[model samples]
Target: MNFSLKRSLTFTIILGIFASCSTSTEEPWSIEGKSDQEVMAIADSLAKTFIMVDGHVDLPYRMNIKGFMITKTVEDVSVETTGNFDFPKSKRGGLDAPFMSIYIPAGYQETGGAKNFADSLIDMVSRLPVTFPTMFAMANTPADIEVNFDQGLISLPMGMENGAPIEDDINNVKYFFDRGIRYITLTHSKDNQISDSSYDTLNTWNGISPFGEQVIAEMNKWGIMVDISHVTDSAAFDALRLTKAPVIASHSSCRRFTPEFERNMPDTLIYALAENGGVIHINFGSTFLSKESRDKFDKMREDLTNYRAENGLSSDDSVYTAYANQYAIDNDVYEDVQKVADHIDHVVSLVGIDYVAFGSDYDGVGDSLPKGLKDVSTYPNLLNELLKRGYTPKEIEKICYKNTFRVWRKVQEVAQGLQ
Candidate 1:
């Protein structure tokens, strides 16, 4: 019990306490001023049960087209530090379930595109049990989605972004069902075999194509949720009238906010979606949210396309993005994450909180997200912001994940009824 011995013990105890304190205060990002501990603390204190169900992800191209693999860590897709999503980082940020999109390029819409793309997407998703065993698990049903979240694994649900892959055939929907695709977007950037598109120059189908109606019937029978994100207004209306089950806009915003954007769902359509028991999963893209941002980005893209055509590199695939990034960075074409919350607010005010969800276009449009909501991991920040905006825990839960799952369950019910 000498004084020297007691002093040594006291110093060791103090040092241990300091070390423990430092470890608890580590931050997730070095660039952001807020520490990781601070972010997690705010998230935890809010008590806003955030089961984030991200509605869309283009995994087919990121893996197959780019030959990239998603291991159980962060991936740096390009020279830019803020590009691509990091798994461990996402989990740390509390993103519950992310639906991985198996998107097929529009080239396949003509002949065997639907069957070929559907087959490939199915094969790729089906192999996850063997390929990345520990990292991913498939969720074919709404219940399975929640279960995966409880088990602490990301539920990589399947969503097809274009019916072009289905070609002119309706039976292909059944084939897609067997392949485990739960949802399918009717069109992409261009009008496919099934319908007209919001982004294309085609006036072929003023709304939905003749084949598109057949596709909807087949989708309902097969129990696949129909996604109407990029479809034209006529196509969207046709889908509402044709679909027996609820449909979803996997990633879209209210056109009411931005007047002329065909990509956004107008108030009239929002009313229809809400009445049909569907959800309009808000897109996290900066351009989709802000008209100013969208206009600027589109101009940049057009300039790039013109530049490439003027030069001999029009056919060079790499030239498009090489020019757009510089344009984006130079013009500061980014929206505040609050804009996301604003869209959510608009949806809630229009259709109530039950028909809205998050559909982050991660990897599909990298560097096009709002400020604080850059990657999958930054979801908690969005939740924190939502909390600050006076959203209750229950409302937040519905917005975060429950609403989407509810629609999913309904879609399943309608499918079951067909049989």
Candidate 2:
């Protein structure tokens, strides 16, 4: 060949080699062209390799009501149960640390005994390690969780769902923290001494009460996270401004999807939370995902309320209970797991992947969990859905636990500084 022809051929050969190298260097497990099984395997592998921390799980409260005798070794939580969380499911789903919710009902705030009720729930959680020594351990800090993860034990961190238990005493914050309570949601379904709730009609406090402000300060000093999940927008804003450490919405979703739903955090609050260097762990309830589900569920609840009023029945009446059960069965609606991922996507878009995490609200949301994520074992399915949505493994890891861990570590640091 002539010199010019040989030069052109050489250039073409070099270009072809570069193209081959580029193709070979591409990620093998990216969802772009992989089969469903390949994506699933990738999800499963990621789930197991990383430390998946769900910000909230109400297992202790659920078992407490079931009369399961959690203090004694009744049954293996690692095995399948009728509830949403168990040991086997947790392992399969790769959930390393799930903060056990020590939920105090709103009614307890009025009838008193809120503190006692909280203590009982805490006792139940404390007994888990004793009951199942090999499978579980109590985690007091981010470091505890990592150590527990290394030991192949699930970390059971505690987060009180309402501040009513603290009642009139700011010292209770330190009391509970010493009891291994790492976070405290200011209010639940109704306003209490701490702050107004999203679900209650009363705006008693407008925001955090003076006592509640002291409580937040004490929680910050004690290194306890302040959870803003069920508090009103005003209360949330107050918390965002007052908290010395990063706050978390432990089990809330994006209100953008289900507009007018106060239980979920709004876009403004989410942005503010991100600004505060905190994390929003998405709740996986159907009504929390879509406005349609919320409307349907609200209609059912309204119908039940109307029926009870018309029949002059109390909330505890078996007749009203039966009617409510039938209503739920007749109007059941399930949200696709993709909706949960969509909320995650929205948070990531608004703030970054660093401000979002999983808080699945398992066992607490009853039967309203999204379709593909019905139980603890289904986290991989949600991860697969995210993979398909183009979330990189690093982004997924941040969502899984890193973001929350960072906030948790920050809270600890702030507490040390305050001291």
Index of the highest-lDDT prediction? 2
Per-residue lDDT of model 1, residues 244-357, tens digit only = 999999999988767799999999999999999999988888888888888878887777778777775743457765766677778888887889999999998988989999
Candidate 2, superposed: residue stretches over 4 Å from native: 1-29, 68-78, 300-332
Residues 126-210, model 2: lDDT tens digits = 8878888888899999889887887888999999999999989888999999999999999999999999999998899999999
- Top candidate on TM-score is 2
TM-score for each of the candidates = 0.81, 0.87
C-alpha RMSD of each candidate structure in angstroms: 9.6, 9.4
Report how far off residue 417 is in candidate 2 (Å). Answer: 0.5
- Sliding window of 10 residues with minimal summed lDDT for model 1: 72-81
